[model samples]
Target: MQNETTKIALLVAIATLIFLLVPVFLILYIRSYNRHKKNHFLEKQNMQQKFESEMLQTRVEVQDQTMQSIATELHDNVGQLLSLTTLTLNSVNVNDEEKARKKIDNSLALVNKSIKELRELAKLLHGEQLVESGIGHAIDQEINWLNKAGTYELKVNNHLVDLQITSPDKDLIILRLLQEIINNIIKHAQAKQIHIDTYLEKNKLHLKVADNGIGFDPNEMKMKKSGMGLNSIYKRIEMINGKLVLNSAPGEGTSISIEIPYP
Candidate 1:
C-alpha cells in the first residue's frame, strides 16, 4: 500500500511540472512572434520615411526646372517682343500724324502680344497649382512649352485633360520624366518628328513618347551605365510602382512608354 501511494504522488508531480512549463513555452513563442512583428513595423516605417524624403527632393528639382524654363521664355520671347515695341514707338514721327498713329497702333499690338505671352508665363509659374487642378492640365502645359520651339513635328493626343482623378506627387514626377525625355531628344536624339500620347485606361495612366531619332543600343547603355537620365527615369518610375518600356535600335527610331497606377 505504501508503494502504490508513492507511484501516485510521482505521477501527480510530473503532470504538475508539464502544466507549469506549458504556459512558459507558450509565452516564449508569443514573445518571439511579437518581436518579429515589431521589427517588421520598424522596417516599413523606415522605408516610408525614405520615400517621403526622396519625393521632397524631387519637388525642389521640379521647381528649379520650372524657374529655368520661365527665365528662358522671358529672355528669348517676351523680352524680344518688348524690345520690338520700344523700337517701333521710338521710330514714330510725332509731327507726322498719320505715321505716328500707325506706329502707335503697331506698338499697341505688340504690347497686347506681350501681355498674352505673360499670361501664359503666369500659368507656367503656378506649376504646383497646375498639378492641383489635375495632372492632365499640367501635362498639357508642358507639351505647350515644347511645342513653342516648333523644332519637332509633334503629334500630340492627350486625353488626360479631362481626367477626374489626381495624384499630386506622381503628377510632378511624371512631368519631370517627360521633361527629361524631351531634353534628351533636344540634346542628342536629333529627331525631326516626335509623337506624344497620354490617356487613362483601366485605372492606369499611360504616356508614350516616340521620336524619329538615331537610336542607340539599349543593352549597351545598360552595360555602360552612362545614361544618367535614363537611370534617373527608371528610379523615379520604380518609386511610383510604374513600368517603363523602351524600344530602339541603331538606325531606327526610339519609343518609350510608361504606365502608372492611378488614384
Candidate 2:
C-alpha cells in the first residue's frame, strides 16, 4: 500500500510540473509575437518619418530656387530696364526740345515696360500659388520669363494645362527640376534654342527639354562629378520614383527626358 501511494504521488508531481511549464511556454510565445509586432510598427513609423523629412527639405529647396530666380530677374532684367529709363530721363535737355521730347517719350515707353515686367515678377512671387494653379501654368510662367531674355528661340508644347488631377508635392518637384535644368542651360549650355514638351499619357507625366547647346559627354561629366545640378536632378527624381534620360555629346545638343507616374 505504501509503494502504491508513493507511485500516485510521483505521478501527480509529474503532471503538476507539466502544467506549470505549459503556462510558461505559452507566456514566452505571446511575448515573442508581441515583440515582432512592435518591431514592425517601429519600422513603419521610421519610414513615415523619413518621408516627411525629405518632403520638407524638398519644399525648402524649391523656395530657395524661386527666390534666386526672383533676384536674378530683378537685377538683370527689371533693374537694368529702370536704370536705362533713368538715364534717358537724366539726359533730357530743355534747349534741345526735339531730342528732349524723344528722350522723354523713350523713358515713358521704358517705364511702361518696367511696370509690365514688375507685374510678371509679382506673379512669380507667389510661386507656391503658381504650383497650386497647376504644373502646366507654373511651367508656362517660367518659360515666359526665359523668353523675355530674347536669347533663346523657345518651342514649347504643354498639354497638361487642363489636367484634372493634382499632386502638389510632385508638382513642386517637377517645377524645381525644370528650374535647375534651365539654370544649367543658361550658365553653361550657351544654347540659342530650347524645345520643351510636356504631356501625360498612361498615367505617366513626361517632360523633355532639348537645347541646341555646346554639349559635353555625360559619362565624363559623371566621372568628374562636375555636374552638381545633374546630381541634384537624379536625387530628386529617385525620391519620386521617376526616371531621367540624358542625351548629349560634344558639339551635339543636349536633351533631357523625364518620366514620372502621376495621380
Candidate 3:
C-alpha cells in the first residue's frame, strides 16, 4: 500500500509540471511570433516610403521634359509659321493699294496675336523648370519676360549667383512669391518702378520686392484693409517656412522682404 501511494504522488507531480510548462512555452512562442510580425511591418513601411519618393522624383523629371518640348514647339514651329505668313502677306504683289493695306493690317493683327500666345507659352515653360537650372537662371528668365511683356521694369540684383537651393519645394516658393509681387504691382501699385534684391545671411536666404507705389501699413490692416494680393503673399511665404516683413505705410510705398532657410 505504501509503495502504491508513493507512485501515485510522483505521477501527480509529473502531470502538474507538464501542464504549467506547456502554457509557459506557448506564451513565449506567441511573444516571439509577435516580435517577428512587428519587424516585418516596419520593413514594409520603409520600402513603401522609398517607393513613393522614387515615384515623385520620376514624375517631376517627366513634367520638366514635357515643358521643354512644349517650349520648343511654340518657339520653333508656331513662331516660324506666323513670321512666314506675315512676310508672305507683306510681299504680295497687288496693284490696288486699299486691298494691299487691308491684307497688311489683317496680317499684322494675326502676327501680334500669335506673338502674344508664344510669349505666354514661353514664360510658362521657363517657370516650370527654372529651379533645376538655378535661382539666378530663374530670375533672369523672369526679367526677360517682364522686359518683353512691358508690364513693369523688373530689376533683379541677385547677389548670390551660385546659391545652392535644391529643395523640391523651392520652385513653388519662388513662383508664388514672384507672381504675387508682380500681380500686386499691376493691380494696386500703379508704379512704374519695381526692383527685386536677393541676399543670403546666416544660412538664410533673403529677398526683397520693392515698388514705388501707393503703400499701406502692415499693422493697420483693420484700418486700411488688406487685399487679396497681400493676404496671398503672406500665406504663400508662410507655407515655405518663411516670414515676410513689410516696410511701408500709407503714401510711403511698399517693400516686402522674405527670408527662408537655405537648403
Candidate 4:
C-alpha cells in the first residue's frame, strides 16, 4: 500500500514537471523567432542604405569626369579656334570686295555655330543650378537648351507646377536620374523624338520622359543588364522614396514614369 502511494506521487510530480517545461520551451522558441525576424529586417535596411550611398558616389564621380572633359574642350580647343577665326577675319582688308566678304561670311557662320554648341555643352555640364534655381526651372532650361541641337525633340504638357518640395539630397537624385535616362536614350534608343511631361497631383510629383526609340524586351534587358540607364534611374528613384514604372516593348519605344511623394 505504501509503495503504491509512493509510485503515484512520483508519477504526478513527473507529469507536472513536463507540463511546466513544455510552456517554457515554447516561450523560448517564440523569442528566438522574433529575434531572427528583427535581425533580418535590420540587415535589409542596412544593405539598402549602403547601396544608395555607393550609387550616389559613383554618379558624382562620373559627372565630375564628364565636366572636366567638357571644360577642357571649351577652353582649349573651341575657344582657341574661335579666337583665331576672329583674328583672321579682322586682318582681312575690306577693300577686296569678293574675297574678303566671302571669307568673313564663312568665318562668321562657323564661329556662330561653334558658340551655340559650346553654350549647349556648358548647360549640360552645369550641376550646381539644380539646388539654386529649383527643379522646375532647371529642368525646363535643360530641355529647352537640349532642343536647340534639334537632335531630340521635347514636348512639355503641364509646365507651371514647380512645387518647392525637393530637399538638397532629393534634388541631386532627381537631376542625376534625368541625366541618366536622357543619356541612355541617346546611346541605345537611337530615339529621335522625346517627350517630357511634369505635373503635380495630390501632393505627389509625377514626371514622364518618353522616347520613340528602338526598344527591347525588358526581360532580356534585365537578364543581360543591358539597360544600365534604366536601372540607374529606377534605383535613384527608389533611394528618394519614389516609385518608377517602365513601359516599353520592341519597336514600341520606351516610357518611364516616376512619382515621388513630398513630406
Candidate 4 residue-wise lDDT, 1-263, digit = tens:
99999999999999999999999999999999999999999999998798677666855854774586477667866787688788878878889988898888878887887887687667656655544456776566556645645787677774523666655566556656666777778778989889988777897877899999998788778877645556666666776689988888999999989898753
Q: Across residues 147-248, which tens digit of lDDT does each residue of candidate 2 receive?
A: 978899999999988988879889988998998899999999989999999999999999999999999899998997757478888988897899999999
**Lowest-scoring 10 consecutive residues by lDDT in candidate 2?**
224-233
Inter-residue clash pairs, candidate 3: none
- What lDDT score belongs to each candidate, Candidate 1 first? 0.91, 0.90, 0.71, 0.74
Ranking by lDDT: 1, 2, 4, 3
Q: Clashing residue pairs, candidate 2?
A: none
Q: What TM-score fits each model? A: 0.91, 0.80, 0.56, 0.67
Question: Sorted on TM-score, highest at the top, how do the candidates line up?
Answer: 1, 2, 4, 3
Candidate 1 matches the true fold with a TM-score of 0.91
The residue ranges of model 4 lying beyond 4 angstroms of the native Cα positions read 1-52, 58-62, 65-84, 87-90, 94-126, 158-161
Decide which is better by lDDT, 1 or 2. 1
- Estimate the overall C-alpha local distance difference test score of candidate 3: 0.71
**For candidate 1, lDDT tens digit of each residue in 230-260?**
9889988999999999999987989999999
Better of 1 and 4 by lDDT: 1
Worst ten in a row by lDDT for model 3: 54-63
Residue-pair clashes per candidate, as listed? 0, 0, 0, 0
